[model samples]
Target: MIYADDSGHPASGLVLYGWIEFSPDHWAPVLKSWLDLRKRLWRDYGIPVTQELHATQFVNGRGRISQRIPPRFIHRGVEYWKDFGREVAVQCLETLRSTEGLTVGAVWRRRSPAELAQTKSEAYSALIRRFEDELAEADSLALVFMDGDGSDSSYRKSHRSLKLAQRRVIEDAIHLDSRSSQLIQMADLVAWCANSSVDRHPGNHFASEWYSTFLAERDPCRSPREI
Candidate 1:
């Protein structure tokens, strides 16, 4: 199966969609490793594994980690922990690189929501085409998983129709909560990092590294046209 997630607000200047594709054979090992990484976050950094692997929250130091900081250092502490959190994300991504039977892809564009919506069909066509290409190379009929809450119904219907029309390329598209799956979380990480790469204001140097790392190994599915 392929787990997918998106990063950046549609209204933002940059938006990214990322996915991790792996076969049934490798799913267990990858998932187990991810779970182990969560444990390591607690053991190594005292960060709870139960906390969602949310990029924005980690960057902003909001949610669970906020309560753990002392009032005196809350501001600086959050910044410090945010860096640590980003490091953990980078480490997790690096580990996933070594796993067999996995390929990652991202499609990003620098355009506002209005511009994208103006040509949504064309964008979907390019993305679906690139996904099918990956499936073809893998020789696998996979289900594409993403968060239903993040997907618009009309867009989902249109995407479904497109995939179904292609015949055996994708088995189906499944939507589940990102919190429910570690793989989905990983997808989120990729999306988040990729967005950071292009976000000049964020000042995250690792974002470009992470973005290049994922794209280096696979053919990225870009918008306006497949690449």
Candidate 2:
């Protein structure tokens, strides 16, 4: 199955879509490793192992990030979130690099204000083609799990638009609550860091190297595609 997520916004000049793929035989072991990472996060920050690690919110110091470790306690500054966010996110991603059964892929594109919607559509379609090619090469079928509750029609259409004889994604995307799925949350991290690699920002300058540093080893693209 593939656990997918996206980052960036229409207001931003760059947007990204990312997913982590693994086979059914390895699913249990893969999930165990992911949960193991959450355990480590809980140990380090006193954050609940089950808490949704929404990359944007978690990094911005929003939500109950931890119980014993206060976000502000990490640093005494208005931007403590950004500082500690870089630290925790980097640690988690580096750890994820060793997850045994996953392959990563992502595609991003830069767009002007007027072109954001159209460019996003094109980029996602390009990623869908990549997914199709991979499944075809392996002669396998896979389900796509995205971070939402099945409300996104664009993704459904992307899968459905594939030539009927050629489409490999099983039915429509199976959306789930990201809060309950650690895999999807990791995909969220993938998306965010992929965006930072291209669209550098003052707030997330610390993530500038995260994509090349952590995720590149697993992605055949080496760097994410610039569609």
Model 1 score (lDDT): 0.63
Q: What is candidate 2's CA lDDT for residue 159?
A: 82
The residue ranges of model 2 lying beyond 4 angstroms of the native Cα positions read 70-80
- CA lDDT scores, all candidates in order: 0.63, 0.80
**Cα lDDT of model 2 by residue, 1-227, tens digit:** 98888876577667789878889998988889888877987888777887888888777666557676645656555446555655677777876689887878778887886887777677777778877887899899988898888776777788888888888888888898988988898888888878778778787787788889999998878887876
How does residue 193 of candidate 2 score in lDDT?
Answer: 79
What is the C-alpha lDDT profile of model 1 across 1-227, one tens digit per residue? Answer: 77877665566645567677777788998788777877776776566766777777775444354324334444643446655556666667766666666677666655666776634444544566666775678665767788556456544654567645554445445777766677888888766766666564546664656666644454344211122
Give each model a TM-score.
0.77, 0.90
Which of the numbered candidates is closest to the native, going by highest TM-score? 2
**What lDDT is obtained when candidate 2 is compared to the true structure?**
0.80
Runs in model 1 lying further than 4 Å from the true structure: 66-79, 116-122, 137-139, 163-165, 169-172, 213-215, 218-227
Which residue pairs does candidate 2 place in steric collision? none
What RMSD does model 2 have? 2.4
Clashing pairs in 1: none
